[model samples]
Target: MTLLTALLNGAVALSTAKIPAKRQSLIILILLIIASANSFLHLWFSEASEHSTNIFVTIIASGIVLSNRAHWTASILFNWVGWITISVWLELALIQHFFFAMAMSTLLSWFAHLARKKLVTKQIELEIERDLAIQHELEAKAATETKSAFLANMSHEIRTPMNGVIGMIELVSQTELNTDQKNYLATAKRSADSLLIIINDILDFSKIEVGELTIEFVEFDLEQFFEELIHDQHFHARKKGLTLALSKGDFHHRHVVGDPYRITQIMNNLLSNAIKFTESGGITVHYDLVTLGDNLQLKVEIKDTGIGVSETALPFLFDSFSQADTSTTRKFGGTGLGLSITKQLCELMNGDISVKSQLNQGSTFSFSVRLKPPRQTHKMASKPPVPVSFEGLQVLLVEDNEINQEVMLAILKGLDVNVFIANDGLEALATLSHSQRLKFDLILMDCQMPNLDGYEATRRIRAGEAGEIFSHIPIAALTANVMDSERVKCIEAGMNEYLTKPVKIEALKSVLVKYHKQAPAQH
Candidate 1:
């Protein structure tokens, strides 16, 4: 009766105990519940033997204690009492029962210790992996920032020399020269322009990598865009003795809303690549429409019969600083960032790019992008006509450089316009102040001059004593600063039009005509 009562009390204690550790807590709880139910049944039934009840309780209690390191000693004491009681009840040998209980406890305790060590080791390994990932991420961010700083510094350094070269070339072209000198100057100018383009590509790639690039969508004529692109690239193709051809697809309309600058950039990169690679065969560009569900996409394809890319080099074509071959770098010089920038710009506009090539035959690059159809609103068939001549017009030319001043004078000589020259902004102000009797029609202000720059000069003229006479004068800003912010600065500085240095004759003529008609009537 005492043995049976002890078994019932042990079963209730085991059932009430809960496993605290999470790894095997649920399994431990389930085993304990099963053992408790078995013990209650054995105690309640009349046919169940006391020896069986004692043996079952001893085995379950031993397992629970052996599975946990904290309970091993207590479990052994409890199991020993149960085992002895059962052995006596069943009339079994005391030595054999004691040996069995000791062996079971030793084996279970060793197994539980081994499992606990392994669990601790796994947790340490996970912590190490997480720390390594964080370290790598930080290193990558530092490298990217370093690269951006290098690119910005390089761009500023390179552009300064390029501006000097192009400016000097413009000044030289205005001088009286033999055919040989003129031809040499033209070649040098072309090389400088190409270098400028490469520099721009590098700057653009840096902007893209740092997430500073953005697209602006504006209404533009698709046909006009194509025409301008062809005009700009045809000279390069001609110089290389390669044929350049364009095949326009049937678009049913001409005007579309898109980012003209980015589209032009992509087209220029593709066209320049094609021209650079091809030596004998021609290059061709074609476009077509793609229909996907309800959306319309445009696909532009540029194909060239050039020394094509190898199988190994094809994969890294769009990677920054990677070129097709080392010899290609020496033979066909580039910064190798054009295609990388082109691909990123396309993706920024929700488009994709692809390329296909053979070893020696040729290569074809393609891109696709969705665009809304042209609006059906009324289209102006004709633009307002510009005046054909700048004859009999009064012009002001302000420049600090003597060579540049002479160059401007020579260009304006045959235009039949009355020209006045000033060495600096202060000189320009004096000239204007003294010449109030003969009202100046147009003021061409140089942006960077001694005593006062173009911005301050324009402001002063607009706010000075000759406010009535010069305030209404159409002042055009001329400078080498071609950045978008520079353009905005010129506009905010009271200038009517902005023209970059090394100005094209046609562009200057157009500006003159634009402001001439818009200028206020004389008092």
Candidate 2:
């Protein structure tokens, strides 16, 4: 009933307010007076039915119509009173079922409006949350890619110089030198080696972040592994005048299954850190064995007498780029990624790590890993080691740089090989074609050179431009392009082997021996 009245009154107001000359204040006053007149007429003329008294009483009780901004509160109160009054009166005047129907319709309309508003608000909130999550994911992905690229570029830059330094050092060590000169060379070599290790740590951390690093299981001699570690670090410890010791536990097995490279890396990191901070006391590594049915676990502990970490810093010890303190980083120069890599490696091997420390006293780092005992196999008789002599071997050295040429000549001269020099691939081809009696046993062709490079020259040589005498002779690539794709290109170009610069004497010797022995069968 109330709804019917409101619709009727709305229609009346719309029709009257459409007049062009209607004044706003006069419209409002006229609406109020009409509403009041209708209320009083209903009260006076209605019969004493169930709805008569209630509907009339409520309509006459309020004095306003067309509720506006300033009258909204009073309008709401009047609407409720009028609605209840009309509902009661209609029920008495009619079948009494209309009251319940009206009430339900009004309640349903209010609930539907509220539900629509809530759903729209929820949708807006969900949109904001999804946008925020997507933004965070994009930021994380960009940061990860950036870190990977930086580590790759950094590794290449650092390793290039290190290759030169270490190669030169190896060559120098074989030369005749006094005791003092040899000591200086050794020190420089050690420093270069340490720098290489730091570079590797950065690479490892980056690999871990990008999910590219992996561990392999293989059989290796545990004693030999430890021996190499101790030998390598003994010099560093001695330089600091600190005692380095290792204690071994007796096990039935000498060989175990695990990645020797990753294991050595972990031990190296722990030992290096221990020696780096130790000033006056010793460092010790102890091992023990734990058995669980068929599986064996090894517990390794590295204890050092060094400036230990504070209790507060222990929680973040395994976090990347976190050192015990800023002073530790200053005194012992490092990027603080070693322990982080070590911890990651341990977990990859299905192991756990722990640490204990006291300030100014010492620290002990321990890790445990499970290992399978290596299966026994029949040992083949080892080949008798052959004494190497580069005599009677004909070598063609193609290089563009004068310093590099001299360096190569010096190394070859020491090997007692018959060496032929070519400044470029063009010269090398000319030499091979012009000489009637001098046929090269092996060509060490530089990849980048004037006139022609190693690839084209090797192609021409294989095409028999050097005559059948020099054709098919092993052409080993002597280039600085060490990437796997570069090596594949050399092989595809008919070169027998690829060697990266700055080349080491041992590697060069191995290549010589391999080709020299294989050359006879090819001819």
Candidate 3:
């Protein structure tokens, strides 16, 4: 009887172990058979009637299973089996052991519940982190969009007034004046030019930040270009009492395919920096052509006898919005973006810029660019003189700002062209519709205006909504939107050309000359 009772207790202990469900069920059945035999033995044998030992063993086994398994399902099965054995043995006095087993099971279940709760909390935390990351991304995107819109609006608003001021200054400078009046005009022009530079730098930096700057390759005469560039720099050098020199090596080829506008901008920036820093010594620009196995490289170097960069500052010389130090910026007066922009442009051209400098002696900036040689040699054409008169040319100048309108009026008056003004796109269309006797030769359309924008107006004109007579009229977009995307938009809307403000007289006249040739031959 004792052996059978021990077997029953051992089976109950193994019940909560990590055995398969079927194996566990077989063990439980054996335990029940042992219990039934023990009950029969107790009924058949007087010694087996003493059930105290069996009750004690069953209670201890139940407690062991509940503590080790720590799972509510296993604990319930153990408690049910223990109670059934006790009842079948008719041991109602051992019911006290059931209460003790239930208490131990409750304690173990509480701990298991806590572990599950901790897991859930950890999962919630991860979910919150993921949500926060998405929110932050959305906020950053919104902020970037807002910044772009603000910059676009500011570009147009500020350049409109600047055009009037700069245009008036250029006109005043052309008039005959005494030495003192000429100096005054020169100073005013310089200040205005400086402001324009700041504006340009900000716009360029923004474009670079947004990855919107692009490069263009076309045929250009490098020799002629350098000659003109040096000529312009000469005036600035003379003002500082410095000599500007250019040295050219043997040229096996003359015309090459590259972005001449970007090249000129980079050279201009380097020259301007040299001039700004140098006190007395001269600036020399040297370039040579090198032939590689299958490619030609143009190596250009600019050496300036100026206050050179210190060793520590050299590393960060090309860093944006940073100068050699606070003192250099305070004395030199610049936004410290020129060299950074220059370096980036060189890299974009598949080249790189390096600098060699000594504290007080000089600095030399050199870069080499690989360019493809043109199949046919191209000679630089002599620039045609600015039109002295546009006697019979009729131009429609569409502008909303009063000051801008006045500026365009003065410029057109100098060209001796009949000028017609419109305040907005709506007015421009209305004017063209009513004017059957006098057809416009060209339209200088501003992109941003009230009632309707220049893009929409151009669309209407191209769609023949403004009458078939106006459909073929050459229209040029004039605005302060310097972005390349804006230029593409203008072209897509049927504008023949794009001009950015503040517009110069030379650029305006050049555009007229270009399209004037294509204009229908006047009767």
Candidate 4:
């Protein structure tokens, strides 16, 4: 009987589970037949163990039934039918053994039900966490986009007024003035320029944070570029009674491909810091070249005899908006973003920047950038002569703001040109349509004007509704929107050139000269 129960347990476990569901019934039927034959053999021998047989039969039935807990009907039916039928056939009708089998199967089923509940709870918790993570990520992205838009709008609003302030100061300074008045104008100009720099730093830091800043590689004259940069730095250094010098390294590659604008910006930051900190002594800039395989590396070291940094503060030197000490900002007067920007630029170029300094002695800032040598050396052209006169030139100035109109009129008046005013785009278009015979050389169109914006006006002009002559006339977009997308919109609207607000006299002159040279001769 013991052997028969063991065989029955093994057969049921294997036949019910290891077999596919479609064949499980047939396999279980065959195994049952075998169990019955074993029981008959045990009966024929009359030498089987009853206790062991009961234990084995109980374990097998409970295990098979508990394995399918979701179908408790099958579990209960199989437990009662299989064990009771076998017990009756054996002629062992003990009520305790039958009760024991039923009790064990119920216990296992209850335990399985609890296990299923726990698994379901765990899965639900994991799914909830996943959804929350996705929601948070979406919120963060939306907030970043909103911040970018706000910064862009604020930039336009602030820069427009600044343009007028600085431009007006420049115009006033051109006239005769006493030493005191000239000093006041100079101080105002300095303040306006400083504010502009702060705005630029904030914008740049935002760009870097959003990963919008990009690097462009183009061939440029390295030596000439450095010479001009150093000349400007030297002028600033001389004003403070400090000497600024540049020493060239041994390996000389005159022309190389890289982003000249970013390189100039980085150098300007380093040199500005060197000059700002040094009160008594001078600043030295050392440039060297290191050859790595076929590529050449440019290493720049800006050594300043200034109030150096403390050891504890050096670690945070390249961190954004961080300074060496609390008193540093008050004494030096900066947003403390220069070094952070410089370091980021270096890394963008696949290079690195480091500093070595002593609190009272001096500091040396070193950086290295990988560069590609151009196919041939190139020389920079001498600057074009400044355009002094544009007599008989007719320019239509379309602007809504009275102060901006006055500013543009003053600048145009200084150039000895005939200027016509239009308060809005509608007026400018009407002026063009009515005065078809009058040949206008250029149209300075202001974006975001009342009645009609510059973009719409330019589009109409391009469509040739005003006149054939109007369509060919160069329309330059003048506005406070200096964002890349704004420039793209201007171009798409058929504008020839883009000028940002609080337009400088020199930049205005350059634009006029460029178009005047290209402008058709008066009919």
Candidate 5:
């Protein structure tokens, strides 16, 4: 009888545990029948031998503990103690003692299965959440990359033409013209300059959005840099018939190590806003330096006696694409990105910016940037190498665009340079490889061109494809791509210098002077 009970309970436990929960009904039913049979046999055996070893109860309990659904049913069947178990009263000869032990076994097994099921469900839910978070992060990253690429492409397309427009106009303006014609040209120039500023602002904003904006730290004369900057903005203030002055605070050091360009940008934004918003009186620029052992903090304040910001608007003044009001934007013609860019630039330099003002009285805009004294006192004590004369200097202007070529040629010619044109990289390579061609003093290579690009041409040049005589020729990238990543690529391609298009005369001249000084003496 004990063996029969063992076999029946064991079969039910094994079958139910192995079968799918949804497909375990047959197995469950068998479990119910086995529980009933076990109950009756346990009672009969208990009566036949009052000194029974309780082996039947032990076998039933083992089966209950070993199987999942079967144990759960058996637990319930034993007065809902397991999933499905028989009532002790259902036994024709119920033995209270034997039934008590069987009941206890199913109850314990049922509780264990219940706790385990809860744990498995919770684990599955956590895994699902983790997967969803990962998917979202990946999607966001892809979206940011796509936006950055789009901005880069658009910047190249737009700047390429802007380079031509501004360059050509400057060339035309240099020629003889009447006062009226000059006035028209001056207005055109101002309009072009404003347009360029807007384009630059948008590009800068895009770079900041993607965390691609890089800050460069180099030794520079801080006082001189700001002095020149204020001098430049003085014209705008003078045009408005307002006063402008700078109080150059006593400095601990004349030269400090920091990102001078970004500092200039921050100052430009604040001072421009102060000038633009002011209607009466004047603006004063104040600066001070604080020494912090290993670092220096340069603080600047721009005070303007102009229209001030409303209390409501002051909070969001530094937020991207925001201004005092929409009407303010309509009156002040700006992308509302300048202040936002300034705020971020300050933070990048481990500094901060703030403004205090009321509606009509005026506002004081203050910002600070951290720097450090040069490790060597005279690291940048000397000014940059002065540009030499452009007379008789030779340059190979490798460009595909005719309009761009015309603009570059006019500028180069104005500088009295001997300019040679190569329509594409392949042509530039062919020109240099020729034994009879003029040994070019410098190669002003354009990056993107048909047939072959400048990068490959430069690599080949460096690899002796253009003969060892010209292989060491100074190559400067003169392209429309303005991203820093693009500059890195140009350097990797063996170019020594990078200058972007709509090339400024001074900038182009600087590059020319650099290579000319180092140019191999003509044969």
Candidate 6:
């Protein structure tokens, strides 16, 4: 009986899972019949009754169920029924006990199959989830890269023309005009300036996102700084029919070192917002030195009567590209980046900012920053000389845009410099290589252009590809990209100075003064 059971089950294994459906069914049925017959026959035989049939049935049932998913139900049910059949057909002692033992074993094995199936299914789900997460991560990185490229391109395209507009407006302002004409010109200039500020806000936010903003500290008179800042904004407040003034501050110093530009930026952001929102009342500003524990901090406060923030909007006031409400954006036009930039600048300078406001009353903003104690300077700060000249200097201007070239030429002419023009980096190289009779005191190179770029041209010049005499000539990158990476890139590519586009006449003169002192005589 044992040999018959083993041989019959072995035949089912030999019929591999690939056997025809009907044939597979036939084979499993035959194993079931023979296994049951073996159980009955063994029960009659006193020697083997205890051990034979159920073991063979378990092997046959589990193997078929695991290997053939299509027939597993039949395999499980028929095998269990086969054991029950044995219990029923036999007239033996303790028949009920035999039936109960077989039923419990079959129930335990079926539960084991279900647990294994669930474990396999869960593993597959986890692997699929991991793959999808990797895909999403890759997509996010690609999107960030795309946005960066778009911003860089947009900045260049916009600033190239902006340089021409603002530069020409300044040049035109220098000429004679009637009172009304001057007023119209002032309005035009203000409009252009406002547009420039918007562009800068967008660019600044981009810089912040990429973690490339730079900060620097300069020495200035504490007394004079507040006076001048108020004076500069007086015209705007006057135009709006709002009084702008500085309240008193508790300070005992004359000269201190701090980031004056950033300080001015923070002040401008707060003051501008105040002026924009206020209809009647004036803006009051205070500068003070406060002692906070062991740290001596420079505290500034601006109070204004304006449309204040609601409780819902107060917490998110400093969030980037966010305003008090959607209506705030619609009523007052702005990119909503100024206050966010101000908050970050405060933090960058080791400070914090806060606001107190009511829905209809007004707002007061306070900022405190850590700064070094004042030190005495040898001389009081003096005003820079008006319309400084670089009369004897010679400059080679490399640029692609015609309007930008004209703008630069006009500015350089005012400085009394003898200028030469090259439309691109290659032309500049060729000019330097061939002009033995003429040498340049400085090369003002633009970063982005067709054919070749400023970085490669500067690299080649440093590598001695543009003749040895011209190789060491000063190259200043005049670009619109103000990102910190661009500055580092210029330095690494062998540039002596870096300047941004819409190049301020003051900045240009500073560049000329420093370079012309080291400039070859009349080159």
lDDT (tens digit, per residue) of candidate 3 on 1-523: 5675577667656754567645665565556445545644453454343444443344344333322333434534554465456556665544464456545544554565455446545755886898998999888778766766677788888888889889889888878999999999989998999999889888878877766678887887779889999998999999999999999999777888888888888899999999999999899999987777666788899999999989999999999988988998888889989989888888888889999998998999998776777767657567788677887788899999888888889888888888999999999888988886677889999999999999999999888777888898899999987876788889999999888889988889998887566555632
Candidates in order, TM-scores: namely: 0.61, 0.59, 0.74, 0.73, 0.80, 0.72
Which residues of candidate 4, in runs, are more than 4 Å off?
Answer: 1-134, 290-296, 370-383, 464-469, 521-523
lDDT on C-alpha atoms for all candidate structures: 0.71, 0.71, 0.78, 0.77, 0.78, 0.78
For model 2, state the Cα shift of residue 114 in Å. Answer: 14
Cα lDDT of model 1 by residue, 1-523, tens digit: 4544454455445433553344343344344444444443453453334434444444445443333544434444444555455446655564364465555544664565456446645755886898998888888888876765565446534654564577678768878999999999999988888877877886787778766567776667777788889889999899899998889888655666678888889999889889989898899989876555545577899999988898999999999988998999999888989899889988987899999999888899999776665456456377666555667678899877776666667666655667899888888888988887787778888887779888898988989745567876888987755444556778999998887655666778887776566444542
Q: Between which residue pairs do clashes occur in model 3?
A: none
Error of 3 at 12 (Å): 36
Q: How many pairs collide in each candidate, listed in order?
A: 0, 1, 0, 1, 14, 0
Model 1: worst 10 consecutive residues (lDDT sum): 19-28
lDDT of 2 at 21: 26
Span of 10 residues, lowest total lDDT, candidate 3: 63-72
Candidate 5 segments exceeding 4 Å error: 1-106, 379-381, 384-388, 435-437, 464-472, 521-523
- In terms of lDDT, model 3 sits at 0.78
Models ranked on TM-score:
5, 3, 4, 6, 1, 2
Kindly report which residue pairs in candidate 1 clash with one another: none
Candidate 6 lDDT score relative to the true structure: 0.78
List model 6 lDDT by residue over 280-317, tens digit each.
88999988876555445788889889888899899999
Question: Per-residue lDDT tens digits of candidate 4, residues 62-95?
Answer: 3342233333344345445654555566665533
Off by over 4 Å in 2: 1-154, 216-218, 288-298, 369-376, 379-388, 392-409, 416-516
- What's the distance in Å from true for residue 250, model 4? 2.8
